[model samples]
Structures are given as C-alpha cells and as structure tokens.
Target: MSVEETMNYVLKIPWHDIERNLISRVQLKKIIKLRIILDKREINYPIYFYVGEKRDHVMIPYVFCSCKNFTIRVMSKKKKPSCKHLIMLRLALDKSMYREIYIDDLTLLKKIINEIIRIGLSPTLRKLLYISRNRRYERGRTDGA
Candidate 1:
C-alpha cells in the first residue's frame, strides 16, 4: 500500500484514540491555540465556530469544518476523517472547555456568510453566482411592471 493509503487506513480507526495518541506534535500544539466559539443565541440548537489563526471555520461538531484541510484531505482525499480544528472542537465541546461569548445573531450570521463565501467559493464562481442572482432579481422586477 502507498503512504497515503496507509495513513488513510490508520486514521479510519476510532478517532478519539488516534486523536489522543497519534496526532502530530504540530497539530497537538495547534490544538491548544485554537478557539471554539459557541453561539447559543438559539436555545434549540447552537452553532460552533472553530477560530483558527488565519480564519474562522464553521462546523457542526463532528459533522463538518470549512477549512481547506478538511475539504482537501478529509473530504476529497479521504486520507483523514477529521482535521486538527475539528479534533480540538470535539474535545472542547465534550469537556466543556470552551468559553461562552455573546455575539448578536445578525452579526454572527454576517460573519458566517462572509466566511463561507470567502473560503467555500472561488472568486470566479462567487462572481458568476451572485451576478446571476442579481440578474434574476432585476428580471423579476421588470416582469412585474
């Protein structure tokens, strides 16, 4: 088996154990520096943001992360199931290690939307998509006149 495949096989094992013992020294160091921000404005369910050095990554606990590492390695390559930010988030949430901070819903939504657009979509794609949306809205307004 190749190195990538071997690592993939190794990481497919139970995450907690691997995360605790096998996570790289660099990742371990980064784990402590990462921040988990919990937005509990909605009592029914809360939103989590993994605040990284360069950007904030939105995640739903074990489900997702908006980082390139998660998108490239975990999702596309399948070489690893979770990124360092994700592991830090899971640990913080389960252990209640995260500090609660209040950010109004509107501000939080703005941050989420901006971050997602910045990282989730390429510039050309974003321009094309938003331009099309504006054109559609203009057409609808004209049609109603």
Candidate 2:
C-alpha cells in the first residue's frame, strides 16, 4: 500500500486555542497588533495590522492578508499554509472567554447592523466567508485539480 498525504480543510478553527495563545497577549508590548476598524456606520471597515510596523488587512473567512509575506509566500505561486494574521482573526471572535474589544464597542454594533442592512446579513457573511481561488482558472471549472 502506498502512503499518501492529504490536505486538511481549515475553513473553521477552534476558538479556544487562538484566545489562549494569541489574544491574551494583545495588551502586552503593543508591537504585534490587530485592529478591527469598524466605524460607527459600517462594519466593512478594514482590519488594521502592525507586525513591526508593517501594516496589513486580514480579510476573514478566506483568510487573505496584505502583508508582503502573504502576498509573496502564499499568493505568489509559493503555496504556504496560514499566517499569524489569519490565526488572529480566527481567534478574534471569542464566545465564552474575554470580550472581543471590537465588538464590545456599541458604535461597532451599530456599524454591523448598518452593514447588514446594506447587504443583508446572509450575503454579507457569505462574501466574507467565501474562499475564492485565483483568477487563473475558469469561473465554474471544477475537475478536482
């Protein structure tokens, strides 16, 4: 029998691990940064990041980021796995542990509601969560490549 390696689906991550390892340290040095930029009017505001002052946005669900490492390492032919920014987002939404600072702000709630009104809740979330492939392939092409 031949042994084959299989890829794991990482669409969902366990929330507890992220909080325990990552979120608990946000207030420590202030060098590693992750900010959900929600206006009092809209939830679509970008996520601001600062890893050694290099800024990026970690678009959730699909886990896309603007950091150079993500662009060159993950997006540009060199297929690497997830980065710390993606993991940060995964752990950002803690349910039972500490309060997520972004969501705790009442202004952010109004923005989320306004965003939901603009696009409807389901569609907005779908757009946020859809893991789209690069444009090199055809739109509907699916052959299990």
User: Highest lDDT: which candidate?
Assistant: 1
Residue pairs whose backbone atoms clash in candidate 1: none
Predicted candidate 2 versus true structure: per-residue lDDT over 14-33, tens digit per residue: 55555554665433321222
Q: lDDT of each model, Cα atoms only? A: 0.52, 0.39
Candidate of highest TM-score: 1
User: What is the C-alpha lDDT profile of model 1 across 39-135, one tens digit per residue?
Assistant: 7434434455544445656655565667888778877887775676666665665446553333334554555547555775233323433465587
By TM-score, how accurate is candidate 2?
0.37
- TM-scores, all models, native as reference: 0.50, 0.37
Off by over 4 Å in 2: 1-10, 14-61, 95-145
Judge candidate 1 at residue 50 and give its lDDT: 49
Query: How many residue pairs clash in all the candidates, one count each?
Result: 0, 0
- RMSD (CA, Å), candidate 2 to true, equals 19.0
- Candidate 2 achieves a global lDDT of 0.39
